[model samples]
Target chain A: MKKSWSHESKEYKIYVVLCLILGLAIAAAGLYALQKLLVPKYMRGVVEGSMIAEYYESEVPHEVLFLGDCEVYENISTVALYRDYGISSYIRGSAQQLTWQSYYLLEDTLRYETPEVVVFNVLALKYGEPQSESYNRMTLDGMRWSRSKWDAINASMTEGEHMADYLFPLLRYHSRWDELRSTDFEYAFSRDRVTVNGYYMRCDISPEGEFPAPMPLADYTLPETSMDYLTRMVELCRENDIELILIKAPTLYPYWYEEWDAQVRAFAQEYNVPYINYINLRDNIGLDMSVDTYDAGLHLNLTGAEKFADYIGQYLVNHYELTDFRDVADVARAWEDDILFYDELRDAQNAELAEYGELRSWGANAIEN
Target chain B: MNKKILSVMMASVMALSIAACASEDEDTAPVVLSGGQTAESAEGSGAQEAGETAAASADAYVFTYNGIEIRMNAPANGIIEALGDGYTYFEAPSCAYEGMDKVYTYNSIVVRSYTMDGEDYIAAVELKDDTVATAEGIRIGSTEDEVRAAYGEDGQPGTAGIEYTLGDSFISFIFENGKVVAITYTAIVG
Candidate 1:
């Protein structure tokens, strides 16, 4: 009886071993499944193109995609893109994006949908020293762009400066970032009323209401790396049969130089694409530099965007006029509404900011005509 | 008596071993016989069938939301058609789990390709009540009558019967003992 009992105990030991093995196997499998389903998941502020790729290729197919830094993002309005130029576009641009960053964004856009025209911002080199971090502005893996995702682990040069941009956007953009706190993309698409001189959209003024002066320009050369990316931007557009339009966005007067304008001309000739310098279009574009500039002259005030938009809108309408959305019923309503928004903004900025850029304070004062 | 004793002892050992193993590899999805909706308020035959399918569908999930099993991403496409409303779509990238190097937080959606077994599904989950504030999105807290009213009469029974072509609004209902407890709305932005 003792020997038989011993044999049974041995059987029990084997069963327990087997059960543990089985449990471990199932745990591993569960882990595998979970990882498979979750790892590729992304948080917000990711490259917008990755999510909207098929959508672009499918809907409102366009020939031009404007790529640039924050200036490119906030300055050019997509609503204006369609209404003014009849070109459907996505703001593949981000706030404070550098040329390198623009390169990746353009790469992502072109990867899925090949546009007929590729517009890029070239003022990056003329600003400060070449900033590679500016070019790396694609959304990182976390809620907002995180510093951990940047290659700044072991003290790289020019690491923390631009890296602080995505992390503490408020640091780089100051009051403007506050204006954009949760600025949804729906602003333009939702047909929200835009006041040209609305306090929210206006540049900040000093307590004395003095408009700040614009930053100075440099004959500074693009870093070799930055220039390489710039060249690649043109080459890629050429290879993909995309027409590259090099644009020098308008700056407040005295901040620009003639030598810089010549540099742009040389590059445009080499690339063989039409380069429209707002500087060149300065007087001819028929815009008032004083009233049009928001913060004295760094960027275009709503007044400026209106006239400048008019210039580009008419230029494109005449040159690459697709369909006069003004006539299409459903879309016409949207276009007319956008035009109406432009008017509201135009009126908003034209008003005196007695409330200190509190132009929107006169909300009911600037009601639709 | 000896044979009976041996059988009892063997059975006890086997049961303990199995239980021990299971506890170590435990998954958290409550196993209330997913084949039938959690015996919630099943007031009618239609409710009963819906309850059954809901249970079965939920039981298959090894994940939980707010400590309850994750049903189909609520407010799925079918309910949107019934509501006769439209929604905007937003897609985000997938996140993998960090420490173990496994992705535990992916929402169950086939976004990019067949290889995407699990990608974060950002669509709002619809609740039966459509009013539970669970912080995930808009939760549903209405009853069956309220759900039918919010969704309209066109909401056909079962997942296949529901038409989501109109847009992506998920209509999720909670039923206990076959009677509807709550209805929620999970807005599925593309």
Candidate 2:
């Protein structure tokens, strides 16, 4: 009877161990589900917020890294670069991304793989400090955990933001419980690609309206803080033997002031880097502002983006000696898939514009709540 | 056998604890007051009075000053259509104020829109010409004392105005030289 009791005890121990394992697995799954439900699914609307995070999903190595605010992401077509120049690229950009944020993003990119050229738009140089928390989250949230992400969060945090909120996003997004939609659950585990190599496509057109005249700034000089980060970006690229090119994309509305352009030009010259102001070359680049722009003059639609990309692609090829990989079967095959996606996205957006009279399924208005 | 029982009990307790925490979150979730009325009032209010008020205000702008049901980030197309087409759209020049891009004016009713992520959303609604009044009959020209009487202790005084918090919304009365210059309703969203 004592021997039977010992055997029974051993069986009980096995049962307890099995139950413990089951309980732990359930607990881990519950937490993961909760985390997924609380996070923003940028699938439906405000897709620019999803662009920065999409970079981590790319398995292919990028030869060029484009960093800037909306002007870079919206203005250049990465698909065009790949299809035409065979130069794979990614744009790490968000709305009003500050210079320091750009620097940190570049740092993060370096941690993954070093690109041959780092193209930074000078438009972000206007702001010396973090602009808004919403914009900051769009840029920072999708970044994988690393020292670079930590520094980016610290550098980009505005007043009232906490490091802990970023560490465990459930704290910040707990309030989203009431605002949850089907997309939240559907995309909890994964997200659809919002950009093709960081290019957001807009097929609709809204011609440029009369922009309010550029008001003279109290101080025309680019902020010292922004200049310091620009210097850091240049130094980082130099250390890594990556060519740093500064370009001001040709968006007419924000009024790239002559004074601001001059400051960027002087900085580029001082650093011995190439500065290309596309604003001056709009005519030469065969851009028709009336038809090319989607939202008045703020950003280029798909048409303008392709044209601009074609121009920039030629320049990148000539200046950087970038290879045309159309001959290479593997690279061409990957690009063909990307082109298919690009065509599908453009067709979908155009169809949406046709059916709805405006993009209903995709912009801010798409959020049901 | 005792040790096995204890382990099983502990696992059960842990699972229940997580469920309890989740339930607590749901229980405390902010109740979205819909259609300018609370759920309790909808069910508990006298049917006759509720029907009468609903029918009377059917065509009128359903302004709820209590709990500030006005939303700032909503598309203004519906609200503008409701307010009728006497409004003119005015674009505030670049750098006028951060985020604020345009204002729609109809008599004394003004709706301001702010640009975020390159799209416009209604940010503020103001009644400045005494053409519109709150559900409580408070208008732009109302005195501080009148506002105090209408809103009672719900409003807390700020530097230049008095703000009343209703749920996730705020109804603010801006006073200049002891007279209310504007009455604004805004809904805050994260």
- Provide TM-scores for the models: 0.41, 0.69
In candidate 1, chain A reaches a TM of: 0.57
Error of 2 at A9 (Å): 10
DockQ leader? 2
In candidate 1, stretches whose alpha carbon ends up further than 4 angstroms from where it belongs are A1-59, A127-219, A253-257, A321-369, B1-190
lDDT measured at residue A68 in model 2 versus the true structure, 0 to 100: 90
For residue B79, model 2's alpha carbon misses the true position, in angstroms, by 18
Candidate No. with top TM-score: 2
> Alpha-carbon error at B167 in model 2, in Å?
28
TM-score of chain B of 2: 0.54
Compared with the real two-chain complex, what DockQ does model 1 have?
Answer: 0.01
What are the iRMS values of all candidates? 28.3, 10.7
Q: Chain A alone, model 2, TM-score?
A: 0.92
Candidate 1: lDDT over CA atoms?
0.42
Docking quality category of candidate 2 according to DockQ thresholds: incorrect
